[model samples]
Target: MKAKKSLVALAVLGTLSGASYAQSSVTLYGIVDAGLLYTSNVKTAEGGKALLQLASGNLNGSRWGLLGSEDLGGGLKAIFRLENGFNVNNGTLGQGNRLFGRQAYVGLASNTYGTFTMGRQYNALQDYVATLQLVSALTQFSTHPYDNDDLNNTYRTDNTVKYATPKLAGFQAEALYGFSNSTNFANNRAYSLGANYSNGSFNLGAGYARSQSPGAIGGAIVGNPSSATPSNPLLDAARVDQWGVAGTYVLGSLTLGLLYSGSLYTNSTFTLAAPRGTIHFQNYEGSVRYQVSPTLMLVLGETYTTVHQSGESGHYLQTSAGADYYLSKRTDLYLNAFYQKASSNLQANIDGAGGAASGSSQAVVVAGIRHKF
Candidate 1:
């Protein structure tokens, strides 16, 4: 009888262990995007020349990632993610070639409480306000001047801790802090806060972020200066502040979006002329998306950006249009076009294009296919 009881107890324990293992799961996901690109002009020492080439990540960046979750009982869970960015055309790693440059984080989550995560992660601007751009068909191609406000997720914060509140009454909030890990304490540190609200057909978001002595510490807010290719040229700044507000409304199959963002780089070392003070950028954008049919969608957008320096200023007016045809639930074909005009003798440089134009105007057209799995 004693031996039989021990055997039953061991069987029960084994069954419980198997049940726990069943509660854990891991998923692999990725996106591949490639396209043919045509640029009206590419700046060169000889002036400007039209160019055609194969481009990667026109609508979305090519990337792959693993997401995992383990249930901890009572509405709690342990979660983690590792994401990598790459160039599909050259088969090269993106984001300075880090193994998991896009995102890598682990956290605990509770259905009743909020979530707390730590690792290399996106700032509040990228979490909240940047999502508003998804309603636009041109998504990544319509970034605000050099993505200075980080609306395009140009970079991620390192050694960071973040917390997000559970949605209540259509409102949610989040905050983050990134440590410099230097003896100086404050050098290259970063912080951000953001909030979102949604009601019926309307959604709104606002965010603010600041970094001190960005790029001064390795793997900090902007990553290492030597390895990271920051979208904004003025990364060597004493301080960087970014803030933005965006809103979107869905009316049946049509959506409208509007956004405003600002980036301020103070005491920057990179400058066109002497006596560098501050470089400030303000961006305003409006976009509309229409679903023409079950499988076709179209978008139109315009952006006006202004830049100011110690004693001079410049302006940019950009227009964008695109169409997407869904080949299936996980694949699509897209066509996008962009034109930009600049003032104050500044050259027009469309994002993702090879180079800037020698004149004040530039245009680009791209046809691509995207697959998600």
Candidate 2:
């Protein structure tokens, strides 16, 4: 079967090539999703960016890009994709000025078995972490404020080789391994494996991930000669750990989902000159959603987080409710609002430590639209 397909592909490419007209195809595809936004307490009490301002991603980020796959030969194929993310209002590049920041990966696919690829890849947590957020396409209202730990970025490993299993009987699994890009102990890296099962109106999935850091990023300003600005070290052995599970089931016009996540910081210490011994930090969460109609639906979500400080203990409850409406296949509009409250060792916040944080409680509300193509 593979040999026959290869010959057919070569024959088609040969007939289309060496022709008079431009035979190569470079098509463009992307999303330009943006809308009105209203945010409260955007900054600190020190007169930071706190106030209602127009924002992007009330639904999605504004972006555009290209994708194409060429017939190289045999059963093998040559494929490349470039996607860029940007702010629509002022036209600024998103994801830190990366041309293909949204996604930049190239590799081959097989008709049978599976496909292998490499690049900066989204992690398993993204697919299984917090429910309310991932379900909303990683909504801003639900992703942060609860855990700035960024189980989001930095967590997304770089230089990764990923394998996606063929979808069979509504079942699929993904495996990924990332390189630390270091000279020694390449094994000192990160990786994850996750699988999803979906059939009819029911769906479920679970995942696991592990990553490490050489050390914390404290600098001269904190009082260290090694840092250009003088730095601090909470713990020379500080490392970041994260893992989570998510599941969702749909019936008729309604769908329900749940998620949980946690992190561990070993040898978590103070950013001060006098460091303490092995301290620790962790987090937990849960959420759910329901659909009212195809164009309009209701969302009720909540997350609970607990932190065990080296010397203090704290926790917070975040509850939210909102509505989502699909304007079209490429466009979606939503309004989300959430409230947060903290307790137990409430105000004694951690200093400039590289461990889990227990910041002050705040509320967030936003209404926006997203479009994809």
* Best-performing candidate as measured by TM-score: 1
* lDDT for each residue of candidate 1 in 244-289, tens digit (9 for 90 to 100): 9999999999999999999998887666323577889999999999
Lowest lDDT sum, 10 consecutive residues, model 2, at: 216-225
Clashing pairs in 1: none
lDDT (0 to 1) per candidate:
0.86, 0.56
Shift in Å, residue 338, candidate 1 = 0.2
TM-score of 1: 0.92
Instruction: Report the Cα lDDT for candidate 1.
Output: 0.86
lDDT of 2 by residue, 112-218 (tens): 56667787666666654433343354355555322333444422455778887767998877888777666543333667777777788666666666555424222
TM-scores of the candidates in the order shown: 0.92, 0.74
In model 2, the runs with Cα more than 4 Å from the true position are 1-27, 41-50, 71-77, 128-138, 144-155, 186-188, 214-237, 268-286, 344-359
Model 2 TM-score on a 0 to 1 scale: 0.74
